[model samples]
Target: MKPSILTISACGIFTTGIAFAGEQHLTCPARLEPDAIQPNHLPAGWELHMLRPVYLTEGGMLHGPPEESAFLVPDNSTSRKAGKQTREMQHWSFDVPHGYTMWVYCGYGGGGATLKLFQQVTESATECTLSSQSTNGRTKEVLEFSCK
Candidate 1:
């Protein structure tokens, strides 16, 4: 039997990937369009590649190595300090076309308890690098990759 996909939309912002109902090949949006009004926004012709999950264990641990596409670096500082949980900050560094500034951010779920708005951050393109901070294990944060 083929697995079913459960897509959750948020005010038409972005669509969630296929849910892991049983056993299925999950895939999310590959790229994100550049927006001018958006901070840390990339210029035209740049698309952010979304990272694919390697394996989400029952313990809420995201295990995977860095990929050519995009990957998150491991950061469990806060988790270590608080003695609660260990959350890793994802860092991605990939090659760009030729000339374009790279931008990184932790978007879509960080802030007030009631209002969960997306947040973004800018990074210098030393060699086309992007990154995301620790997550709350909710899978709402997005780690983008691209150059502007």
Candidate 2:
């Protein structure tokens, strides 16, 4: 029957598995300056070393053909001191063709620098929020932003 044939065809397609195109990764940093500090801004001392967007696939983030970018930040606030440093990790993510450039500084956090992690939104961005953690504690900053 046609129904039986259709079921067979569907099964065949599913067995083939999906083929993904490709992906990319880029690590960026954000070095904060005195003037850069504002309400809800990145913590003090932490610096961003990489900032980039990347195209992803089924298996995972690809590295070639239709690739993009990714970012990495340094842990400048490893100390438990208050004014010593900003103990935490900061991450930013979005889609909808977002774009941003940076300006690093010379100052470092109270302790030292560590690395942070983040996730991204695809296709479109709405009510985006970059998360941040301090002194290895719970998230402290929720940066509300809009993607262009």
- lDDT of all predictions: 0.28, 0.24
- Candidate 1 lands at a TM-score of 0.23
Lowest-scoring 10 consecutive residues by lDDT in candidate 2?
A: 1-10
| Candidate 1 lDDT tens digits, 39-144 | 2455788855434322211111112211221323433312222243344333334344454323222223224222121212122232222222223454433233
Least accurate 10 contiguous residues by lDDT in model 1:
57-66
Best model number under TM-score: 1
Q: List the candidate 2 regions with Cα displacement exceeding 4 Å.
A: 1-67, 70-119, 136-148
**lDDT, candidate 2, 1-148, per-residue tens:** 0100101121221111111232212122222223322233447987643333221100111111111333324322122336523333323342223353221111123222322212232233222222222333322222111222
C-alpha lDDT of residue 84 in model 1: 32
TM-scores of the candidates in the order shown: 0.23, 0.20
lDDT of 1 at 14: 31
